[model samples]
Target: MPRSHPNSVTIPVGVVVRRTPGVTRWAKYAWTVTDILPGAAPADWKVLRSEGDVTEYHAATLPLTLYVPDAEAYAHELQARIPSIYTVLRPNAESGGVPWSVALVTASPYEAQDYCDSAEELVEKLPMPHGLHALIVEFVDKHYEEEAFVKRRRKNARVDQTDDGIGDARIRQTTDVYRAPRRREVAN
Candidate 1:
């Protein structure tokens, strides 16, 4: 069973959502959130500016839990162009509306791999705030240890040629499946 680091912290973060009109090759009109706002407040989403079909919303403020075991992974994630907090979104079961149920993922890659395989869930990467980055770095420096990668050598197989191939006439037979035909034979 997998375990989470005992020293895990939950921090509150805001998500920004934008509803934009998109046209497919089939000329189908679809409304999708093209931009995500991170570290946004609930009030921000409420007062979003809407011009025509383009609307911006501050979606929700939710708790992002960071585990100590994933500190190293977080450190690696910080190196990305946009070091982000990953959010998992799914359709709201009760609302029957466009709004989605959101979850902030702070797990390491090893732990989060299971969630990646879900087709129905939408995974969004929101840029991490400077302050949050500092905090995560501090946690990682204190707890994260770089694991040494050692390559294992394959075991050598014991060869007993006399028993397996030398005495057997079938082994020496030039079967069509195992042997290439001579070029001269092919030309003839």
Candidate 2:
């Protein structure tokens, strides 16, 4: 890695999803991400396990990237009872294919929140594996520098000394109907 971008690293991650019978009447089947594998090889809907009515598949291998700038967000997640990695899945609308595809994998909660705001994408949380957790902690320890809190001061300008934008400048006071004489009203 270059010195300019030493704080960033990518780790291969596999998304394992489970398919089950849909509870609703409109849908035939339901899908959900069950687990994540650290340093897993690339795969596409390869069956991992099957039990009764449920089946698990290795959907896709995505790169889980860690960045130094987002260390604070990662720290927040680490404080939780179970630190997790968020996966965003986009609906697949193309004919004759799986119902969903892996869109993004994010460690930062803020970034994951942005995806949640959109209606088109679905977000799933999976427990962070020990190996990935160590990598995140090591990366945070090496490059996570606590930024100092600096109080922002407003610009030094006299605001109460002027009426620059108080009223409508386009309408002259002498020609304004609100300020015009009542004689014009009586004459109408």
lDDT per residue (tens digit) for residues 82-139 in model 1: 7766766666687643456665445354445556798877776556677887878787
Scored by CA lDDT, what does every candidate get?
0.62, 0.84
- The per-residue C-alpha lDDT of model 2 at residue 78 equals 80
Model 2 lDDT vs. the true structure?
A: 0.84
Q: Using lDDT, give the best candidate's number.
A: 2
Model 2 worst lDDT run, 10 consecutive residues: 173-182
Clashes per model (N, Cα, C within 3 A)? 2, 0
- Model 2 pairs whose backbones collide: none
lDDT of 2 by residue, 146-178 (tens): 789999877996667755443566766545444
